[model samples]
Target: MVVHSKFQSDTVLSYSGSIPYTCYEIGHTWEPGCVKTFFQTFCDAFKFSIRVYTVFYLATFVIKLRKKENRRIKKIKKLLRDILQSSIFLSANGAFFMGGFCMLRNLIGKFYGWHGLLAGFITGILSIQLERKSRRGMLALYLMNLAAETLFNMAVARNLIKPIPYGEVIIFSIASAGFMSLFRQRNGLPENLHSPLTLIVGPEESRDFYRNGGNFSQRWRLISCLPYLQKLLQRLKTVHRSHQSCPHNNSCTYYTLEGIFKQFLLGYGIQILLNALQSLRGKQKWSKVFNNISLASFLAGFIGLFRACNCSLRWLLDRDIPALHGALSGAVAGTTLYFYRSTSIALYFFFKLMEVLYFRGIREGYVPHLPSADQYLYASTLAIILHASCCEPHNIRPGYWKFLCGVSGWKFPVMFRKLFDVFGTKATTLYPNFVPDLDPRYVKTTAVMELLKVHGKWRDPTNF
Candidate 1:
């Protein structure tokens, strides 16, 4: 669907009172000069975003820092610049959001929920240009994941839809199944993109095996650790002859186990580091740290089961129905979600499936291609987040709310929100601890001192 940004929408309701900067919270300091605000917002966002972007991009260096075209010093400089570009992308997006809200209030004569949408959408188009083109689709995809979940929760809250048990698992299973099916059909994985399944199932399953070798797609790269175990694996040759259609080398058991061990160690290492970081905050749960093997086992089980099921079913049936076997095995493997459940992981794969399907549709002439979908998705997602942050803080994911707080330089608490009650979102009621002076309707009301109250003991801001 073509999502055209406009002031008029079906969502419009009460137009009472002014929606100007002073009347409502725009989630920023209401200073003059959009240009100045943009730069100010940029610096604040950069301080936080650089640390985040650096951590995120850190793995790239660890994985392939040696293959860069630039020299050691130059590579570091270029990487810093690249990271800066992303920080700017995030900072500029927030600045533009504030600017857009202000502009919309003035031009439209009032503010509405859709105003956020319009502003977000416009800024998305403009700001996306500053981001690396390669990352645009990925950014859009991530936001789409968040948007999809937020909308689902909203629907459930409104009683528009019933919640399903293990819904995320179901979604992940289907998506993974679709992915495996496509991979087997030799037309699913994106060109030149590294797929995680390559390590699990091996490169023989890949269509561009020659081109993709050593490009983070090979199964052999990670399993070269543990010299003693390596010696043992080297001695054991293929125990079972390969089925004619088998896209793997050596015995099936060895191939399957190698992936399991590698992935297990990888997951364990990651979880340990995370646990250590959490420990640094003086909240060390020493009681459960050693026993926290769920992540490791889950990763191992994921690939172990997938390889075992696929190979066993293939050999037993004596024929490889690529789609059927691939899908069935994928579903079976996804059942390991019981080992470690994560809505975030499942949702990520679900959108990945959507991307695969959408692209496939375009190729097969079954779907209309939209060139600007990524930009729109990113913008709209941000719009939803900004709107909810002020008008319905209770509805947003707490972590995301904190993220907005960081990026906006702690502006939400200072934002004027009492006029926000005009929209009937119950902003004051839900987030009752906002600054006392924030409510334009009434001044000098005592703000809650606790700051982080949920249910039992929150000071209500509505009491005049």
Candidate 2:
């Protein structure tokens, strides 16, 4: 059976001491108000970083990095691209955050004994499909995820191992969607205009295909879309017998860059407004805002059902999977949230160290193989710091854990132990069983020493 003792709490409340330190009178002297100060400082620093990165991204274009040859056109193009890209990024991020929020909400309900969790799960699945730009791919991903989820849930229900917590499920779903994004990167389209589109079939064609279900029916239905099919050719000949040039066919290769720009502008204008409003409540500083916008845009430009799936998967399972010692694990988890940011700022400095060391190599002029090498490293490093801070032992308390489970919105028991085990291998390495040869005092402060000391010791019964 599963059990939770100290974690149980009524009405979620914030507490800050030595973080998770339980110093009941006869314990070590602890910092009184450091936790609250740390959180506030972190947020303020993060906001500043976001502002700097945003300014640089906009500045780089304005300085004409892309179009140095022509001053006038450079300004126009730079402004145009920035506006268009920013708009797309904001909208996609809004969708991403919202989708993730809903996915987590559903998972929480399902894991806990809430009646509405299953209902929410069904709605989330359908809503995600409807929200996707590609119905076919979305349907495919939905079915695939549903299968995985059903099997995983069955295993949990039967007590084959441990019950996966709602937190882990939320993380897994988001990670899966992120992984799908990586695979969905388009190799065919140009960098600028590769937005995804939905595929639709006519009504009459749908009916005819249902009536005759053989190979012939399939071939004929597909041929209907082609203008050069034998049936269409005969019909065309009957309609126009004249072998003369038509007025509509007169030669003209007029190109309107302005029209293309307008099309881009109009579509993005509506989109940006929606996104900005969605994210208005969580406004950070300029650099952090910029980082959020750029990262969001990069993900947006590669929009598709597959990418969404990638993001979801990464959120769900990335934490569990072992990679490049502890380096890859931290980088993957952190970078998923941060890339394309600036240093000097606190969050940037913190997260970037991870990116530069673990993920990116500065050989020759570029960090090869990795996607968006520079941005990824910069952004990921920042994210690692933020995540570390958020999940740190000191920042955590019984109330936050309850709130994280959505127990108030829907009181439900989640198997966090099993959930942690899903990513146990990676987490184990991070909170290693044995201390290294070096002195503990000399190790990097960012090693999450406090968290490691607790979970690490817990992993070994003999050590206790």
The CA lDDT of each predicted structure is 0.67, 0.30
Which lDDT tens digits does candidate 1 get at residues 213-317?
344324454554767756767654356676776666566777687778788888888888878877777678855455577788888887888888878887899
Put down candidate 2 lDDT per residue, 1-464, tens digits, no spaces: 22222332222223211112221100111111223322433343334434433575677655655565646776666655554444333232222222332343334421122212233333333333322242333233323333333334334544675743343423433443332222123221122212221111111111112223343234246545676775553454355332121111111110111122223344355546555665676643333332234434322322222222222333455422212112232223333323222211222223323332333244434655554343333223222221211222122223433332231111112111212222111212223242222223322332223333444422332433
Go through the candidates in order and give the clash count of each: 0, 53
TM-score of each: 0.78, 0.21
